[model samples]
Target chain A: MTVKELIDSGKFEVVNVGAATDTKITDVFCCDLLSIAMSRGIEGAAWVTVMGNINTLAVLSLTDMSCIVLAEGTNLDQAAKAKAIEQKITVLRTDEPEFKAGLYIHGKLG
Target chain B: MSDTITLKYDVSTDDFTRAGEASSDVKRKLKNMNVNPEAVRKVAIAMYEGEINMVIHANGGVITVTIDPDCITMILADKGPGIPDIAKAMQAGYSTAPDNVRDLGFGAGMGLPNMKKYSDDMKIETELGVGTTVTMKVFLAA
Candidate 1:
C-alpha cells in the first residue's frame, strides 16, 4: 500500500506530507530507539513511534522509510517538522498507541 | 572505473537533535554514487551508531568516510573518557549512558555491537581519559 492510502483511510492525520503521497510502503516497523530503527528498520516501511526528534528524521532519511507515523500522542516539534519537509519524509499523526497503529498498518497492507 | 572518495564531518558536543546529520549526508552520497544497496545500508548503520556514540560518550569528535572500489571505511575519533573495558562495552545491553540519553531513544547498549554487526570489519583504538577511535569497514566489492 501507499502512504496516500494510509492517510486517506482516515485513520491518521497528516503532519507534514511530502509532495508525492505515492510512496509504496513495504511494512510497518515500530521502535522508539533510533538505533534499533536504524539497524532493523526496513526500507519502504512506515515507522510508528513516539520518537519525535531530528534524529528520527535522520533515521527516516537514512532508512528511506516510506513515512513516519507518530503515535501515542507524541509531540512533533516545529524544528522536527521543518526537517521532515526538507528531508522529504511524509509525517503523520495518530492518537492511538504504537501497537494499534502497527496492527492497522499490518492489516491494511497485507 | 572507480576512484577513491573521502568525506569528513565534525560532531559536536551533546547535540542530540543534530546527531545523525553526518550519517544522513553520507548515506545520500552513497546512494548518489550508485553503491550497492546492502553496502550502503551497512555503511549507514555503522556510521550512524558510531556518530551517536561520539555524542553520548565522548564530547563529540570527527568522522571521516573513505570510499573506494573495494570498501567503505568509516573512522570515528573522539576525545572523551575512553572505554575502560572493551569487552564489557561490546556486550549487548551494556550501556554507560545516563537515563536522559535513553529517554531520547538511544543508549540501548546496542550501538557498538550494531556497528560491528553491520560492518564487515571493525577495530577500536582507545585510551582512558584520552580518546577513542573506531574504525569500521563495509565491503563494497562483494
Candidate 2:
C-alpha cells in the first residue's frame, strides 16, 4: 500500500513535513531495537517503531528503508526531525500501538 | 580483475551517534562496487553488529574490512572488559549492556547471534580484563 493509503486509513498520522509519499513499500518490519532491525530488515522495507530519535534516521538511511512509521503517536524531537529531513527519510506518526500498526501495514502490504 | 580494497575505521566510544559510521561506509562502498545484494547485506549486518558491540561494551575499537573478488573479511578489535565466557556470550538473549544502551534501541543480546547468522565464518579472541577481537568473513557466491 502507498503512504497515501496509510494516512487515509486514519490509524496513522503524518507528522513530519518531509515524508515521502512517492516511495513504494514492499514489506514492513516492526522492531524497536536498531541492531536487530538492521540485521533483519530488507532494504526498502517500511519500519514501524515507537522510538523517536536521531539514530533512527541514521539506521533508516544505512538500511535504505523506504519509510519510517512512528507507532502510538510518538513524534520526533526538533533535532531528530531535522536530521530526518537532512537524511531525506520519510517519517510518519501513527496513533495505533506497535502491534496494531504492524498488523495494519502487514495486511495492506503483505 | 584484481579488485581488492582494504579500509580501516576507528570507532569512537565518546559518540554513540556515530557508532555505525564504519559499517555504513562499507555498505556504500560494497554497493558502489556492484557486489551481490545478499552478500553485501550479510557483510553489512555482521560488521554493523560488531561496531555496536565495540561502542557499547568495549569503549570503542578499530574495524578493518578487506574486500576481494571472492570474499569480504571484517576484523573488529577493542580494548574493554572482555567476555569471560565466549560460549555464553554467543547465546541469543544474553546481554550485559546497561539500561541506557537499551533505551537507545540496542542491547537486545542479538548482536553476536545475528553476526554469526550473516557471516560464513566467525571467530572471537578475548582475555577477561584485556580486550576482545572478533573476525568474520562472508564469501561471494561463485
Candidate 3:
C-alpha cells in the first residue's frame, strides 16, 4: 500500500506527513535500535519503532524505507521532527503498544 | 564515470542530528552516477554505520568516499579513544557506547559488524587513546 493510504486509514497517528508520503510501502519492519533497523529493514518498508531521533531520519534515507511509525506512545522531539520533515520521510505515531502497532501495519500490508 | 570522484566530510561529535549527512550525500551522488542500486545500498548502509560510530565514540572524524566505475571506497578516521580489542568489539552484541548513546537507539554493538556485513571488504586500524580508522569498500559489478 502507499503511505497516503496508510495515513488515510487512520490506524496510526500522524506525526508528520513527510515528503515521501506518496512512496509505496512493500513491507513492515519493527525495531528500536537504529543499526539493526538499518541492517534488517526491507526496501520500501514502513519502519515501526519507538526511537525518535535524527539518526532515525538518517537511517530512513540510507534504506529505502517508505515511512517511519513511532509506536508505544513514543514521540519525536522538535529537532527530530523537523529533520523528518526536511528529509520528506513519512513519519507516523501511535499510543498503542509496539506489538499492536506492528500487527496493525502487518495486517494492512497483507 | 571512469574517472575517480572523491568526497570528504567532517563528522561532528555529539551532533547526532547531522551524523548521516555525509553518507546521504554519498548515496545521492552514487545514485546520480547510475551506480547499481544494490551497491549504493551497501555503500550507504556501511558508511552510515561508520558515521554513527564517529559521532557516538570519537570526538569527531573525517569520512572520505572515493568513487570509481568499479568500486566505492570509504575511509572513516577519528582521533578518539580507540577500540581496545578489535576482536571483542566486533562481537555482534558488544558495545562500548555510553547509556545516553544507547538511548539514541545506537550502541547495540552492531556498527562495525553492520559495516563489515554490507561492504565487500573492511579493515580497521586503531590504537588506544590515539584513534581509529576504518576502511570499507563496495565494488560495483558490471
> Which candidate number has the best DockQ?
3
- Two-chain complex of model 2, DockQ on C-alpha atoms against the true structure: 0.59
**lDDT (Cα, 0-100) at A86 in candidate 1:** 81
Candidate 2 chain B, which ten residues in sequence have the lowest lDDT sum?
B14-23
Off by over 4 Å in 2: A3-11, A15-21
- Runs in model 3 deviating more than 4 A are none
User: What TM value does chain A in model 2 reach?
Assistant: 0.84
lDDT of 1 by residue, B35-111 (tens): 99898899988999999999998999999999898899999999999999999999998999999898888888899
- TM-score of the second chain of model 3 compared to its true counterpart: 0.97
Question: Can you tell me the DockQ of model 1?
Answer: 0.80
For residue B54, model 3's alpha carbon misses the true position, in angstroms, by 1.0
Models sorted by TM-score, best on top: 3, 1, 2
lDDT of 1 by residue, A36-81 (tens): 8999998999999999988888888788788899999886787888
TM-score of chain B of 2: 0.97
Worst 10 residues of 2 chain A by lDDT: A13-22
1 or 2, greater by lDDT? 1
- Candidate 2 local lDDT, residue B105: 88
